[model samples]
Target: MIPELDGATWHKSTYSGNSGGCVERGILPTGRQAVRDTKDRERGALLFGPSAWQAFVNAVRDGEFGG
Candidate 1:
């Protein structure tokens, strides 16, 4: 089940590229992570459990999605 995101505070990384084409992440009330596009806040977000979010971050750090 999705957690309540009403009061979630989303933030983008300072290391994000200058293109402004990145996603912001927020921690939900249930401890899951929520992600949404920087340019489309009204579109909603994707929710991920703590472990899944960690794995995704690790993959990105490892360049799994390419530089």
Candidate 2:
């Protein structure tokens, strides 16, 4: 289980609107990224190392996962 999440600042995408259908992102103390469902904050999160997170973001930007 990851630690230090209590102090992590969480935020959703600006494009998320108010549909309550997006995940929130947090930057962990170790510079890793954590993602959790916006509608279920207490359910823990998916943690990713910096490189993996960047790769995922790049893939999203490139439409690798398809919209």
lDDT of 2 by residue, 1-67 (tens): 4567877888896667776678889988888898888887788998889999999889989999876
TM-score of 2: 0.82
The candidate that achieves the highest TM-score relative to the unseen native structure: 2
Clash counts per candidate, in order, are 0, 0
Query: Lowest-lDDT window of 10 residues in candidate 1?
Result: 1-10
Candidates in order have lDDT scores of 0.83, 0.84
Which stretches in model 1 have alpha-carbon errors above 4 Å?
1-3
Worst 10 residues of 2 by lDDT: 13-22
lDDT tens string, model 1, 1-64?
3348786878896666888878889877778889888888788888889899999999989999
Off by over 4 Å in 2: none
